[model samples]
Target: MSVRRLRNLLLVLIATVTLILYGCSDEDPTSTSSAGFAGLGQDVDGFQDAGSNSSLTFPADHSAHPDYRIEWWYLTANLEDESGEPLGLQWTLFRQALMAPSKRPEPTPWAADQLWMAHMALSQGEQHQVAERFGRSHSQAQLNTTQNSQAGVVANPFHAWLDDWQLKANDEADNRDFDNLTLTAYSGEGDTRFGYSLTLTAEGPLVLHGNGGFSQKAANGQGSMYYSQPFWQIEGDVTLNGETKTVSGRGWLDREWSSQLLDARQSGWDWFSIHLEDGHKLMAFRLRGGGDDTDQAQGADYRSGTWITPEGQATSLANSDITLTPQATSAVAGRDVPTRWRLEVPSAGLDMTIEAPHANRWMTTSVPYWEGEVVVTDHASGEPLGEGYLEMTGY
Candidate 1:
């Protein structure tokens, strides 16, 4: 095999083993040995923990946190073609540290200290296409540019990539780093080709979740540093099934990192990102099985969220401030996955029904899950309220 091909195979093997052992909340929820859902609630003895006192800085905080065990750059878009048909797409790059910062191996071409995986999916109606790739890198190695590593992120230029699949700053100017960005990734070929080349421009300031970026995930205080760019105007071309179309719509990009992100008893989570018609945005999630003493015995769930106004104002929503109930389920991939839900926020005077128009949007990657675009409507009148995305894991 060619040297490059051989290296790629080796990296894939390493990444596969790392993901299997370390566990990813959305990737491997079936792991029996994991401390929490997909090992996110596992103990972090040597890794860095996300604390409430730590402050988040721009450009610098945008880069990788090698001291943490897990991190991800995730983006989801709700788009439409000129004909008005809707399409949803997702691009995520996940990083897993093979060892703690103190235990990293010496920087060498053959030694790797980190495992990287990238997942991209495109869904339209019943047609859902997905692809995954893996790569490896030495955290200690100098990654001044994209060519220095197979997969890595640079904070200054705001580039996160794995192979040709990349999300980077559209402008080289420092001030425009995260505000104006570009995303490009494609997989398959011939009749099965699929991917997107899109420009994402931020419409609002970045919103921090929970206690100023310290997003609490459970009652036990386990959590991660979470923030998002939820107001994005996206425009570009998307190629699916070997046919390309001009598309434009709204997008949301999420950034999170942590060593332990869940409580030991939590088994899974249902997450939502919504963009209302009135220019409001909402981010909510429920971690199943991590409640308090009485609640834990009854298998209760912990919920948290952020309510955002169009002008970039944010309000943190606590467990008692919101309610999410799975109103219906669909048999997908041999699993009973919730495809319809009732979301309520009394403070915002919102009572809405969220449903996935398409139930076949199951990602068939190494670690499978259900993710798709959802439509929101007023529960009382059934009037269309907005649209967004839903992600359900550990079904």
Candidate 2:
């Protein structure tokens, strides 16, 4: 099928999935938290606007948040095949708080107020494969534990998991490194199937974003708590396109959670996470909004990123230094999407062209958008710079 046609198909799939999701929840909207905080946003109670917060804590903070409305475990990797061909892969799990803990459906054995969604995709030049899944769990059931849910993080043994996807260490010794860790993710059916089982070593310490994991998303202080382990040492096998090839590449893991993720005026965002040639990693994102038109007195385009050096230090990329311009638009998931973009970070002395390996990597979930692996090249020199992932939403 053509790219545009495939995009349309994906869109229909996503829309159908969303309608099914709405039908699954027959709860009375009035019985929930408050007005305006409809849908999954209702799970949070008394949510104040985002503001400068104190530094975050480890182990405890890295775990799940039942009170919050939404959270996610997002991972993306830029890999190479046995023949040295570049490939991009992404695995993400999102949790949406459905109802407040105070309002339980019943003491019934099977009840739930938590919604879970997962997305997995593979990207190669002009070709893409994407899949999405959704499930619901009750706080009163075995699905969610008071100490920890089915999805959680524990420091001692160093384990993080949700459903079938997981990353855990083999040894529990304090001195033992997370290097001997196993990561598994699988989905799809028959000829359209894809999955991965890999081992990851911590090549470096975890890097925090925006002054130690408090990423500011909007001028009004609505943003997500975010962090990344961008320096993973990864090697293993991934089954794709009817073949399982042993692959090795640097992987990046990002963890983010928040009650109010976006501002009312914001529509979506364009985000990039890249590993450069000279031992550096860059994460940049643009938030779409009605900026200058607002009384907040800030511009509509908001962008920020973390540039990490091989030596394990991070520098912030400000708005003025970065640029994202759409080169062309392609239909994805029934929407016209800018699948190609020109990205430049002047302060880092980098100018690159960002293009998807394929244009059909759109997740058909409760909330859908275009997200996939992308190729980066030096704009001036026309040299292949590196591989990374790009996500564009609400367009």
Candidate 3:
């Protein structure tokens, strides 16, 4: 079958999965807090923990690891609309192994041992449009060629997808890094239509988070296999509110997974990937309720970051090297969410306050949360620094 045809089929599958998701939930949105706060942390029994010594390989590692309990392919962009207005967009596909590898279900027609979910959003000005989908598939289905599974990922021709929403290889680049990608996704109808068709070109090598991609999430040794392609130049067409515009800008893509990432007491986190005008980028995050009691950690949160230079040099920031403080809050989706913050990385000489242009950029997905583009300015001089994306959860 042709790639285009396969995507069309997946699109239909996505609609079916979306309707199914909406039918299952009428309660609160399941934010990241759902795992961190609501006491809904996944039971980690047979699944394997991401080890510190695990090596990350290309192409193969880009595909699904059915043994991990959870993993996600995430992309975020800070773009400019045709009219020069700033717009932000996000696309993410999550895979959750419902059963351990040892107990994985057979590839029977209706047997499923994995759950797939995808979240897509577009934010511009005060408007944000979001959609979420859910699907089920057997772990071995990805290996079969005859039947089309609900969702799966392949590495050689590098493609990660859920239904029709996907980030896939669009060129014949022999590079196993999967750096040349075309991202396509859409949802909603009428004036609420939203999605983007973008092409991303990698500008730098993939960046490993924390200690060579074993990103510790808590005070304890718990962590996830984390890495990112922090350098992408994006150009595409974004459709919103039934209008289409051509945009070009910078983008970031993150790939991570873990059996159990955060400790039960940890609340949520504030994650930032800022692109500075001065040939630098900063990636930082803080998880609440640090498991200090066991890890003998000193802080109340788990903080770590990477300061990436223009030439792709990465310096991992320890807890003492980074500080994040909320400066203001805005009521979004009936929750008072932090929309302003002071981000300090003294060693890097960064003391800036980031602020979201508007407080309404809330993703009302099945797992509602706040994510949007923000402007960075020097804390003291208030001079423009640059622009980037900010994601806050569990607030």
Candidate 4:
């Protein structure tokens, strides 16, 4: 069969398997069960687990990792008003696997292993708003067309986007460097809904996380490949409360993928990525559950990241050196979220408290969570340090 034709066939088969596991819903629910619409839990099987043996490549390597089970392109920015008050924004897409294609128990229409989710949020002063959406697809389809599955990195064009929110280089003219990118997003209804259409320029090189993208997540070798571009100078327009404003700031982009995310015993995680005033970047996270902060499986906590300098040198951070704590919780999207945090990195001589521009930015996805932009301040002196994006998943 032709490549396109074969691809569609695979998609259809996968979609069929997916229908058997996850029931389809246009409105979309936040749970994992397909929950009986049709085509789910009809078949079961076991197969040899595939192993990753491929070497990493640039540009293209920055693209998709479909062979694996999950991936995400995450972006968050910290902006300021004319009077210098802070604002925060976030846009992210997450892909997860319901089942491996080879493990189908039975075959039926619209069953597959692929699922996609997206979240967008905006925060300014005391206002916060968030939204989320989800969809499913087979790797192959009969008509050669699919629904809600378009995301990847293009080397030459230097673009990474999903659905409406995008980050693409403006290189059609002459710039080879992906120095300029456009970002846009919108949602909600009447005057209550809002979004931002903006441009971001690269001010520094991309930072690879955890030993050239091999980030360890659990003690058992469960982890992800991760990277980030944390120095994009941004400018654009934001529309909130039916009012549009010209804004400028810096943005950070993080990409991570893995077959296993949460340690099976862990209940949740609190993660932070900060861009410091001194031109260095700091990131840290803690997985909760399994033990009493002492057990390797249940109480065991894993944390590590890169501290990137302006000169482009990166230093690995150890768990013993960094500390993260939730300081406050507030209501968001019908759930309580810890929107305030205390972070410390002794090796970098840094201690700060991070707080959201607003407390309501929550993405209600297949796995609902809180992810948004935050402002950083000195923990001891209460001085403004810088800003960043914070994510709390599995809460």
Q: Which numbered prediction scores highest in lDDT against the true structure?
A: 1
C-alpha lDDT values of all predictions: 0.88, 0.68, 0.80, 0.66
- Across 1-395, the per-residue lDDT of candidate 1 in tens digits comes to 89989987887788667657655544333233457766777888899999898679998888888889899999999999989999999999998888888888888778888888899999988899999998888886435654478888988678898889999888754576889999999999898999999999898999999998999987778899999999999999999988999999999999999999887767779999999999999999999866655544554789999999999899999988899999999999999999999999999999999999999999897778889999999999999999999998877
Candidate 3 structure quality by residue, lDDT tens digits, 330-365: 888889988999999999999999999988878786
lDDT of 1: 0.88
Best by TM-score: 1
Query: lDDT order of candidates, best first?
Result: 1, 3, 2, 4
Pick the winner on lDDT between candidates 1 and 2.
1
| TM-score to native of every candidate shown | 0.95, 0.80, 0.88, 0.77
- Per-residue lDDT over 1-395 for candidate 4, one digit per residue giving the tens place of the 0 to 100 score: 79656655664555455544443433222223322122211122231121233234666655555556667788888887566767788877766556665654343454555565667888886677777655444434211322234444454555555456666667453675455677778887779878898878888887776666666664545467777888888888888898778888888888887655544444557788888888888878776542234534435566666778986678877666667777998888777888988887788787789988666666655445677778899988889988788888655
Error of 3 at 207 (Å): 0.2
- Best-to-worst order by TM-score is 1, 3, 2, 4
lDDT of 2 by residue, 1-395 (tens): 89656644654554456445532344432232221112332223654223357466665555556566667778788888899987777877776656666665874433556666677776666667777655555544432333244344444455656667776765643444344567788777776678888877778777888866778775655567788888887789988877788888988888887777655445568888888878888899987752334543543667788888988798877666678788888887678988778888888887888877578878665566778877788877779888788888665
Please list the residue runs of candidate 3 whose C-alpha ends up more than 4 Å from where it truly belongs after superposition. 1-35, 38-43, 144-147, 172-177, 291-299
For model 2, the run of ten residues with the poorest summed lDDT: 29-38
Cand. 4 TM to true fold: 0.77
